[model samples]
Target chain A: MNLVFDPAWLPRLGQGVLLTVQLTLYCMGLGAVLGAVLGLVRVYGGGRWSPLYWVASAYIHFFRGTPLLVQLLGIYLGLPTAGILVGPFLAGLLAMTLNTAAYQAEYFRGAIQSVKSGQMMAARALGMSRAQAIGHVIMPQALRLIIPPWSNELIYMLKYSSIVSMTALRPETMDLFGVARSIAARNFRYFEVYILVALFYLAMVLILTVALRWVERRVRIPGLGTPGRGI
Target chain B: MALLRVENLHKRYGHEEVLKGVTLAQDAGETKVVIGPSGTGKSTLLRCINRLTEPDQGRVWLEDTEITSRRTDINRVRAKIGFVFQDFNLFTHLTSLDNVRLGLMKVRGMPRAAATGRAMAELERVGLAAKANAYPAQLSGGQQQRVSIARALAMDPKLILFDEPTSALDPELIGEVLSVMIQLARDGMTMIVVTHEMGFARSVADEIVFMEGGVIVEQGTPDKMFRSPEVPRTGEFLRKISDLYGESR
Candidate 1:
């Protein structure tokens, strides 16, 4: 079998890659905000109306337990049966948001807990309300701890967006993998197309990893240092 | 009338009783230092005053208001009382200036500009004006504690509580923080301090209270309590600490 590299396909692959990046960016941003708000309610909302703990707990368990592919299918296909006819783009976005929120909530919860209790008391003694203390004191420190896990979530969501090709709204909204598979099917160039797609993903992951590490360094506290500093 | 009064305060953690019917009083602008052995409730007693650890049963009155049982607004009561921790729980993420300004802006409703100015002044009082933009992690343990003191002072509280403020510091760093405390005492800030620093207790305290086994063992002027002890426990504790340090040195 002869393999021919076509330069024209490169722009199409680039378009697919851009869509994947956009999907991941939107999903991670929305998921992180929702997850953080829910996690805070679970930890600090100390009242009868605060069902956030149970609701967030159940949501996380449900989403994390099932595969992400099934979640996308359920939202895209099953919702229409119940008279909720969301567009394929919206369905894909919603499924990814819910899926990522579950995982990110756990990260945020652990980060929030790592902040010392004395910090909260110090804020309160300074006359800050519970909300002010959490926003000004607790969340800022928690963000430092949350960064590593969040970056992991971002990578996972980026790869996961490929599952959206199963949805019907945008037949042209092919992710890198979907595009590569279609190209292989049409031209019978399986090896070259698959390799190209794999290389693209590897390159994107490398770039993302570098960017995240730079962010981690920028936000790090100086003397207290990272967890394993001097060790 | 005492500026602060604790009447029949009791506290327990599970099976361990920390403060057993402890009662105390401090006059306005008075500096009261509490000294005791570990687990003797000195820290617990101070914490209860600010409701950091709510009491099991008691009445704490800040002047005329019954703080303990009133339920009027604990946050409002807390605003009048500032606490400094041994660990210097300055928010690690915030700069020293933000740490001081947070309560001033959020609790007191002071505008950002005014609060920042007040915070800077407080940092200056603690001799950390130059380090305002630095985070707690960048500072020495001594500097962090000073920032904690500055954060407390920025609230302009009616009284301050210090819980072993120097116990967590290196020996060399202790003097700097204690000196700031001394200055605050000179400025007539009402304070209740639970500390192991006998020199600080002797110099700045208007009254000294000694506690052991969850009760106040003895209390009086530093002259009376340290020089002429009424309780054997007080004398034993002082002698023990002094002998331990003397032998180590």
Candidate 2:
């Protein structure tokens, strides 16, 4: 058991972190937008069995019901079968984006529903159309309620991103897990290498948790969900 | 045409009949208060007048427009008909000023600067100008209801429906909201109110309607109704309410 760590491996680890961060962030952006729109469609799309509601409901159910690893492989290998060929990066990004969006949609829908019914009635009474009320009135409050759950999605993606590398993602942008795996295989120090990678992931999650917890504090509605915490 | 007319309004909830064939009319610059037991549909009648709660059978008209018709642009009618709720229903996420300014800017399409000015004016009217930037969650229940009043007033609606606006407030706080309503009544605003505040009904309402068992049992001038209600049910109900709530005006 050679306990000696290598500084030379730092650059490779850094590169993996960059790629993983990029993939997580890009997926988060797409997920936020898609989730909000789809969540609204599910709850406020007028009636049950309406086309928009059904499509959003089905999409959420399908993605949420399946595994991320399976989805990544499906997009990477299965897409080419249907004449929709994409490179590894695109495949990973697309799969993560869709998966994140599905989960985010449910979170957002739950938050939206949690808003008191009086808020909707007030907005409608003030001459706002159903869309306007949901958009301007309901969404603003729901966004605050979503922070805790949405941040959960974010940190989950920070780690769930590791599954992307299993699907032929270019080695250069593979991820910290890949870097650790290669290091362990070459040096026969699987224990030490895996421990280091675990620390790296823990660091990412902690940083994100602090940052998002800060946001949840900033947007805290008084007398609502705030637990008397301050900046 | 009356400023507002509700004809043969009927509403049913599951197995319960909430409002049955209630009809009423009021001209411009009139204030009416509907007083009844909790489940008698006083709130339902006001909500139905604004189409907030669609009536199972009947029609409502604002001036010449048949507001109950499917062809009517509901937003337009709703814009002109303000509704203040028992729970205040202030936009909890927004500040007092934004609550007042939202409909003016968004629905009426007033410019931001103009909306702010108008919103401030209405806030001032309700004596909440200092709290304009304060969120509804930060305000007292009475203050929240005042902000809602300012919100409805900013729209300059043709009619305002107050569905027990002060019912949720403490006895001490009800005065402030009622005073604001008194000022609005004096200013010739057309309003329909549902309230347990018989004092307000006595002072401000041109007509006071006493309802029971899903029907309007009697209606008359406050003086006539308070002194001598035509129906025995109205007198009995009023006596019970006065007994429970200290006294009826």
Candidate 3:
């Protein structure tokens, strides 16, 4: 297997890496905000029969049950038919953001539920209104609890982002995967180009994991989240 | 008028009736100790006073204001009435000082410095001044309960309800929590404590009320109830508790 390739591809691949990182960060940031709200709605939208709860649940179910490829294609190609034409970058970004938000919402919901009910009772007993109690007592602990799961989501989103390249048909919209595919097609060295692309993802994922683990440790409240560690 | 009043409170959980039209009153600076077997609704009664557990029927009054009324603003009422739970329930994410300070700043709108000072004072009262920066998980069960008490105290509540505050503690650690309650009672804090600690009930309670089957079966001055109870069941329950706990001093 010839490992040698054109040195000129380095800059293009580096640019692809940069774009991939940007896309992941943007989707994650915006997805977290959107997901947190949706998670709250699913948990506190007032029982099974509630219309808002049903709506949120249905949205989550649809995104989770369907294919990411179809979603990207639908937004990129299908939206044009609906007269909502968007460029490849915007379409890919939108598709990934909406998809990740559904997954992140479940993570947020689980994190919130993992918080002991007693905390809410104690907060309410302290004279905090329900909203105040949720914001001050519940969310602080819940956000900490979410670190482990949220980081998992972060890594998943990074890898899953390769799927976004299918929507990026234009040269300017190329992510690491898109750039690699185009280069592989021209050079006909599928093995070498794809292997290098895999390495880029692996490197980025390793860096992210280490960075997020550090964040988890820094924000961790002593004797919280992990049980039996505290008195 | 009574400092706190509960009138014919009723609560039912599916097939079980937890509280069956129980009524009670407490005057300012009075400490009432409630005792009963598990499932007798003593905790439910305490929760009802603060509307933590809504009663199916009946009303609660703090001074003259009806806490059960829909317009009463339960948050304000809860602020004025402190509650210490069986499990301590200290905010696990916060240090002892922040746990105490949160209610003061968030609910009372006290300035941060003032809240800090007040929280430190309350922590000192609980003998936890040095452990102010420690999270609840780092503290012993006794210390955690004390921090929760301090959290309640920082609010300067008109009344405090203790729902088996020491029940969740080890026998050796129970004394530390009881001592704090005894001190609070000595300092003229109005309180209603639910417990099996006969020694605490005898030493500190202004009145001892014994409940069974969701009703107050007997109530009287601690001396009268301890020495000569009118109800046979109250004396029986007391004997059983003393036998199990050896009158927990």
Candidate 4:
């Protein structure tokens, strides 16, 4: 038996994609802000002066240690048992944001460390306060180097956001596979529907990679980034 | 009071003392050159003076302001002391013009237009006006060092410290950087330069300080040190460098 046409399901799948896009973007945007703050605290905070270092370290370890599936479930299901209730979509969004933030912070810290120590000294020696130096000189250069890694996180987030759909809540916009499941329940054409959804994900990732590569080309310094080229 | 003073500056790292009781004073418009062998604390002394490297013990004064004192604002003192590094540590991301303009706009709070105008003049002084838009990686070593000098001069510092400014350049490139140093001296910029270029020392330096064993082993005027030095170590050091360069004097 051959798979039949499913034009009726196209609209449902489109809605699912819109939800996925929303979840990915919100998570990434808010995550990046949190991550940047966490990364800076890790890099500049030193012995006995900043207690935030321990907090950042612990956050990264916990989020990165547990699987994202457990995290989503913990927020959606476990919270209700503890008498702390949240809407399904809200729980998923919150979990994805924190999960993404922990990973992104590590990438940012690596990029920040790659910046030459001399850059800070030169700025401070000029009498720019430490904050001003980090803001103007250090962050500008670090931001450039981080593009390649940061975009990787964005791309990763697209796939990572899929776990939100598995939560007990049925967010209409977020469940691409649920659209396939609904179609499968009717026609039992499970393979064809899911394959179509897989194609959509592949296409999205492909487009994202090309766009990010273009940005890297436009902004990269000739000899000051990556290894061996910089001080 | 002297324009800049270092009193018995001392620094140690795990029992290895880098600078021991090093002291010096500079008057305004005076050009002092420090000569020393590698690992002999020449750089440490300069860094301590600017508080770039904190001395384990000592005091530094920039015209009656106790820079090393706990109450003193070190940033203000450092702003007045322009430091030119051996590697020409210009901010790599910015253009030559922006590097010079940074301090004026950020530290001094000058408007962008005024900072740009002053930065241009400083670059022109180093004969690099045409390359203001070039990034540090785009320029030659000599040009990059010159841009670093322009960055320092743009601050209108009370005194400039050159930490082996031309040591990383090629022999031919070294001459261009040295010439700029000489010109700054001629223009009456108070400078304390650390270099091995005997020619620059003899031509432009008011006082030549030879440092060894983390101490000011000898000090004399340029002519006196070069011709009839009182210290055997200073004479031997000069001969060794002259042999390496093959420039008989």
Which candidate number would show the highest DockQ if scored against the true structure? 3
| TM-score for candidate 1 | 0.94
In model 1, residue pairs whose N, Cα or C atoms come closer than 3 Å (at least 3 residues apart or on different chains), thus clashing, are none
lDDT of 3 by residue, B154-210 (tens): 999999999999999999999999999999999999999999999999899999999
Overall local distance difference test of candidate 4: 0.88
Candidate 2 local lDDT, B206-243, one digit each (tens): 99988888888999999988889878878887777767
Rank list by TM-score: 3, 2, 4, 1
Instruction: List clashing residue pairs in candidate 4.
Output: none
Candidate 4 TM-score, C-alpha based: 0.95
lDDT of 4 by residue, A37-146 (tens): 88898998774356789889889899999998899898988989999998767887889999989998898899889998989889988988889999999998988888
The 10-residue segment of model 1 chain B with minimum total lDDT is B240-249
TM-score of each: 0.94, 0.96, 0.97, 0.95
| Model 1 residue A217 distance off true place after TM-score fit, in angstroms | 2.5
Q: How far is candidate 4 from the true structure (C-alpha RMSD, Å)?
A: 2.4
What is the lDDT of every predicted structure here?
Answer: 0.86, 0.88, 0.91, 0.88
Better of 2 and 4 by TM-score: 2
What are the per-candidate TM-scores when only chain A is compared?
Answer: 0.93, 0.93, 0.94, 0.90
> By DockQ thresholds, what CAPRI class is model 1?
medium
Report candidate 1's fraction of native contacts: 0.88
DockQ numbers for every candidate? 0.73, 0.75, 0.83, 0.68
Q: After superposition, how far is residue A79 of candidate 3 from its true place, in Å?
A: 1.7
Residue A47 in candidate 2, Cα distance off native in Å: 3.4
Q: Specify the poorest-scoring 10-residue window by lDDT in model 2 chain B.
A: B240-249
Which sequence of candidate numbers ranks them by lDDT, best first?
A: 3, 2, 4, 1
Q: A120, model 2: CA deviation in Å?
A: 0.6
Look at candidate 4 and tell me the lDDT of residue B29: 98
Which ranges of candidate 1 are over 4 A from the true structure? A45-50, A229-231, B245-249
Instruction: List, in the given order, the native-contact fraction of each candidate.
Output: 0.88, 0.77, 0.90, 0.65
